[model samples]
Target chain A: MHKTALFLAAALLACAAHAAAPKPAKPARSAADVLKDSPTSDWRALDPDNTLLMDLAAGQVIIELAPRFAPAHAANIRALAHGGYWDGLAIVRVQDNFVTQWGDPDGDDAAKARPLPAGASPKLPAEFSVPIERIGKSAGFTKLPDVDGWAPRAGFAQGFPVAADPRTGQAWLAHCYGMVGAGRSDAVDSSNGTELYVVIGHAPRGLDLNITVVGRVLKGMELLSALPRGTGAMGFYDKPEQRVGIQHVRLLADVPVAERPALQVLKTDSTTWQQLLDARRFRGGWYVHSPAHVDICSAGVPTRPAP
Target chain B: MHKTALFLAAALLACAAHAAAPKPAKPARSAADVLKDSPTSDWRALDPDNTLLMDLAAGQVIIELAPRFAPAHAANIRALAHGGYWDGLAIVRVQDNFVTQWGDPDGDDAAKARPLPAGASPKLPAEFSVPIERIGKSAGFTKLPDVDGWAPRAGFAQGFPVAADPRTGQAWLAHCYGMVGAGRSDAVDSSNGTELYVVIGHAPRGLDLNITVVGRVLKGMELLSALPRGTGAMGFYDKPEQRVGIQHVRLLADVPVAERPALQVLKTDSTTWQQLLDARRFRGGWYVHSPAHVDICSAGVPTRPAP
Candidate 1:
């Protein structure tokens, strides 16, 4: 097994997958392997209207909104972005293995906080969850073979990781890495989509059906995920200077045509996705044991530059 | 939820469980709640000999070695730390959603790398997986009731997160956030414990049994996880100045007794631990549905300031 002496080579997060332990004399074909052979039809382009171009000092992060799941929040977020709501705001909290929150730091103080722009609202109906039946055709759910402890079924839906209860015909977004959600108070209906957070580490699945999952970061996650964690409790920066200022959060539609993120995500219902799932379910090669199972968060859906 | 319009307050990752949404009108009481009632006997102090106090400019990170799983690798790591082999080294790679690597940046080049100290061996047999039967009484295995897709069983051994294959009677470390592993080439035995990395985001379980996992970072993970991600391919810094300098990696035994980390980890096999597990499996209040199941990675054993 000591074939290569490239110390830094194996340290990379390889996208390739394996077959099973005591592997055959050939390389095991996994996710990376399957993806390379996927048909072009399996990949879909991002919709500019439903996309966000979050420009920070480090780089740009692209997010895709889920209008079908949380219509009011989605509309408000789009309106806020259209009104240049987050231009001067700063990322205020980065709880390790949890989330990175951003908004007006003085949002709590009525006198000091930045007032909501014309299109933005102070409150909206809690879209924490919705009936699966209402999700309709755009829902696009593909349940995992393995059962989840959190939901009756777990899988990808409408291009977002989601958990569903077949018994109640209910469904909503699941909080996997890069998934975005609205920040709210103890009251379930408190969030107005002004403040938002991105899941930066573990998938706090418990957050499912408890908050408004607005969108997901499709690219440039490191810009937010790798920022210095807040020293203050729950990962809040102790000082104002530590927070990274948000340069602009323009909706893709508002940005110049050439400046938009030219990206595409693999469709969850495509044949390539099924191949990726199979490869993950039976990894071999360097693996001593084939998990024969894959976790909802661990099986990351691949994203790439549009060809 | 709009009890107060504290923007930053609601944005921070709050652990206070919700208690509404058709819930049982009572506190679900998970680890955050049961931890308050844990007995002193349920927690164990960190043994100086098995601990590595990694001093960085940001702060100190303490790692507890898993000697039971990889004895040779552990011994080599201890020897390297005791000899100050890693002092002045720099963290060279920070792959978001993957790992943070630290070691001799010139490790791959035989001409420029730091030589291993006297007691450290350059070549050690791979300890990727071992027969469970050989595990001594010190290796405590507590299997979770929920099923896993990765291994036959998921549990903790010697307080380290682990996966086991009962058929082959083998067990090894399960990759989780904070797990520390030696960086290697493609070779199975390329690592000598000098180049190491810690999981900073999602658990790359595919690396399990493919590399040598030595220990786990018990504290100061944010110091590594939150570092600026390198723009270079594979998250390596293109410029030498981008790396974070390491001060010293002194073994606990080498440090002055007065300066040791006064900390203890909650025992995994204790009744208190079981209660915490039950709480996670059946969380109710504020929860729309209790996921009677929990992932092995999500069931992180707690570590806290020793009373």
Candidate 2:
């Protein structure tokens, strides 16, 4: 009986010892890992109709339009693309830590400015925002779990970074890095999609709800961001020769099928996205302290080549 | 008596009419206007001993060191400058939407590595944060009005963006655009200030409290940020020819007095700075919606050539 008791105590001790031993920590899943493990259903292919393919001397810059937020501007942009309005135009302004603007260099000179295309409107009503109800909770709006200083609520809707105010019942595209907007005069309704600018520096959130944000760059932002900054006021190039010439600008639908970019954007509402957020929030390995927070602009939308 | 009474009634009516008339609205002051009106006392000249002047083929890039934050690292950097350690070295990495790193290309290869200067320490402890008491309210700590996700509290201290945790009693320099940091390996204390990088894109706040930030770029950021992004992994240039060569690096004090850069930085504690903040917060004219909040990084430390 004593021997049996000793054996039982020894077994219990062994169990306790095993339990006390520290197990090796599992490797933290990175955003890349989450993307690799994501199902095919979690990624959506770009609709050619809603895409713009702009070619510069450096490289191609692909942009995805956000018609739900700025329908009129998007439509006008499509018409302008079809009209090849920006084919030979130039990136006239590149303000360091601000934006890169591309349009007709003589846009301010009415006599020298190019005429608007038949389908493109000469003037557009400010499409700064739509009704909040249009992007209801039922929609694929993955809200960020953090406070934004500029917006009431911030999130991603249909692959675009957006801000919404339930109290005002308004939703608008945010001015995150790579966000494209229409440049306008002092008048609210002056912009007509002729002058477009891309945010290449920090997200100019103050511009949110103030300008007509039409789309965001899906790929090749480096081509635009790395351009030499203009020395003129507001970063306008002093000499016409300094402006970066555009090779071509076309709607992706107009491109040959074989030349179309095979790209996929991760769905923000997927489970893998949630894992990505957690991974960003609690960064492991080499990181001594993780703030348990991610800025709306910093939590970039992930993209990959289509399989 | 009737004529007198009629005159009195007329006077009263005139007074009432004057009171009812609306006052003309005052024109909003712009940031440029504020600077124009600023007193010389509101601007400070750069301290020659605390400045680094590096010449590339493009132009001169100036850096202002933060010795209070990382004294040992700063001392090591001063030694390096005296030894001309970075002379003829190359800018080897430029990650798009990230940093521009520079150092000896063969730093990792023991046989080909450049030797550290006589006074520069080969190994140093991580100087990520100092005691919060070091940067107390008594110091020139100007707290920002908006909330930041990365730090418990964020503000400017002596023209440098800084984050502090009162509870943890720690304060560290923030990783804002243009901010410079010492690049280390996986180990926290691995850096001896030989390799350095500058933030060239959006503020990577995730790096806060993780790496030792040493200084900030005072001028010529466009030269660094506009470099072609390296095509290799982590943005390292795959070929030696792709690396941008550094012509010379020297302490401003070491240079001839006439050759020193004459520059001034706006004092954050001045009344002009408050006006500048208000001007930025309440954008007028072209703006339709003014977001009252400004991110710490977006509220750039204004610098200009000395008049």
**DockQ, in order, for the candidates?**
0.38, 0.26
lDDT, candidate 2, A1-307, per-residue tens: 0000000011111112112212224445565677777899999998888999999988899999988888999999999999999999999999998999999988889999988877999988999999987676656887775556566677788888888877678999998889999998777788999999999887888788888999999999999998999999888899989999998999998999999999999888887776676666556667776655666788778889999
> For this target, which candidate reaches the highest DockQ against the unseen true structure?
1
lDDT per residue (tens digit) for residues B33-130 in model 2: 77887899999999887899989999999999998899889988988988899999999999988899999999999999999878888998899999
Top-lDDT structure, candidate number: 2
User: For residues B189-235, what per-residue lDDT tens digits would candidate 1 score against the true structure?
Assistant: 87889989999887777678788888898899989999999888888
Q: Comparing to the true complex, what docking class would candidate 2 get?
A: acceptable
Error of 1 at B64 (Å): 0.3
Q: Which stretches of candidate 2 lie over 4 Å from their true place?
A: A1-27, B1-28
TM for every model, in the order presented, reads: 0.88, 0.90
Question: In model 1, where do residues sit more than 4 Å from their true spots?
Answer: A1-33, A134-138, A282-289, B1-33, B134-138, B284-289
- In angstroms, how far off is B105's CA in candidate 1? 1.2
lDDT of 1 by residue, A101-137 (tens): 9999999999999888888888998897788775455
How much does each candidate deviate from the true structure in C-alpha RMSD? 6.3, 11.8
- lDDT for B77 in candidate 1 is 91
